[model samples]
Target: MDYVFGFIGAGNMATAIIKGLVGNSVVEPDKICVCDVDMDKAQHLSTEIGIEVVSEAEKLAEMCHIIVLAVKPQNYAEVLEQIKGTMTEEKVIVSIAAGISINYVREQLGMKCPVVRVMPNTPLLLGKGATAICPSENVSTRDFGIVKSMFSLNGTAEVVEEKHMNSIISVNGSSPAYIYMFAKAVVEYAKSQGIDENTALKLFCATLEGSAAMLMESGDDPDTLIGKVCSKGGTTIEAVNKLNENNFCETIKEAMDACTKRAEELGK
Candidate 1:
């Protein structure tokens, strides 16, 4: 119960989760550790977040109660090989590497290692992340709860079936990029109309935030809300007409489908 968390990668997502844990008092700063091949990156995070940076992967794995594999999917094999010596029954491995599965981690470790697969979005950096986690069959319920709570320290964490993890990747994990694209388009359009770039950005960003709040607070459905804004023959209707003409809905569907397809491919 020291709740020490060790991150193998000192990347942005790992940095976000580490800050969240400390900000929310889930784990003390001194107990968190990071070890990366890039010593500079490790040292930066250590100094920036007040976390310990260990030079050796084995030391990080041996000292921490929970090990978070936060590196890219391609680097998992290398980190797996490096940490293999530190694998123990008491250690729990939680991976946020995209497209990696619980079974893959167990196979990499060459043991019935308790593993949790997590897909977390970039919004976690802002303390509003949405994360979906699925655990290996070897993980006990208590162990799973500890893992889930660790993520919940920064954002909404839910336990889901592993089969659906790929699908959820489209729903939330990569959805932020799609949303950002939409917002960027909106901001650009405003600039095209001769509005100040900063003003347009503020307006469009606020509009997005307000729309999300309305979706959560209003009892009515989304289509109903759209209809409310698009009153018969209004400016909103004109924009909606153009969007429909451009096949906006189908475009989004296609993009999301592509994301899910890639996720499926990566897991294989």
Candidate 2:
């Protein structure tokens, strides 16, 4: 492929996507270009990944067909302004910065070029992420497909309305941290009960993995699945009763609601 892919930042998210794309053979190393404020970091990544490193954002933009805005939300405006006049109709700009809206990019770029906004979680580093994609009105179907395929190298990608991005952030982007917190609590409780750390971690992870697999494979309602496992007067039922008494479900809902609200605020 003759297409060049450029990344404006070379942080973890950019690294993950670059690794995924190159590892999957979706794009060759030479076809990728990167530019970061820290030239040393850019040079390091270029040497490690075999892609070219440029010092200027305009230089990267001018050479690539797809430009990924991997910088932080706070830096997005400045980056957009830097390349606004240089971006052409043939280039598609994709942003992974949290809270930076498509309209912001559109206005900064003069609303003439295609822009795609994507929300991807940290798990993308492990190639198991769930990303929600939103394409601006200027994006064509062909461009959307290209952007979707790019993210698909790291994980699944689904196109959703921009209005639903915050919800997706709560459910997918921030959910991993929630799961980690739950797992930590489980391990701590196990340790209190005299289990060793390694054993407890193994048990906790296996249980979570199996439970997630069951949910995916059975297509059964979660409550129904729990009911099947927790028979009357059984040990599992007793544990379920304890969790219910502690308002676990309600607490989890509240936490997710908080995450959704924060995401909305950031987008503003």
Q: Candidate 2 at 59: error in angstroms?
A: 1.9
Model 2 agreement with the true structure over 147-204: per-residue lDDT tens digits:
7877787888888899887777777888999999988898899899999999999988
- Residue 146 of model 2 has an lDDT of 70
Report the C-alpha displacement of residue 214, candidate 1, in angstroms.
1.5
Per model, state how many residue pairs clash.
Answer: 0, 0
| CA lDDT for candidate 1 | 0.86
Q: For model 1, how does the per-residue alpha-carbon lDDT over 1-268 read when each residue is reduced to its tens digit?
A: 3437898888889898888878877778998999899999999998998998889887789888889998888888888898999788678899887688888888888888888899999898888889999988778888787778767877799888998988889888999998989888888888899999899988888998899889989988999999989888689999999999999999999988888888777766
Against the true structure, candidate 2 reaches a TM-score of 0.93
- Model 2 is weakest, by summed lDDT over 10 consecutive residues, at 259-268
Off by over 4 Å in 2: 1-3
Query: Relative to the unseen true structure, what is the C-alpha lDDT of residue 77 in candidate 1, on a scale of 0 to 100?
Result: 89
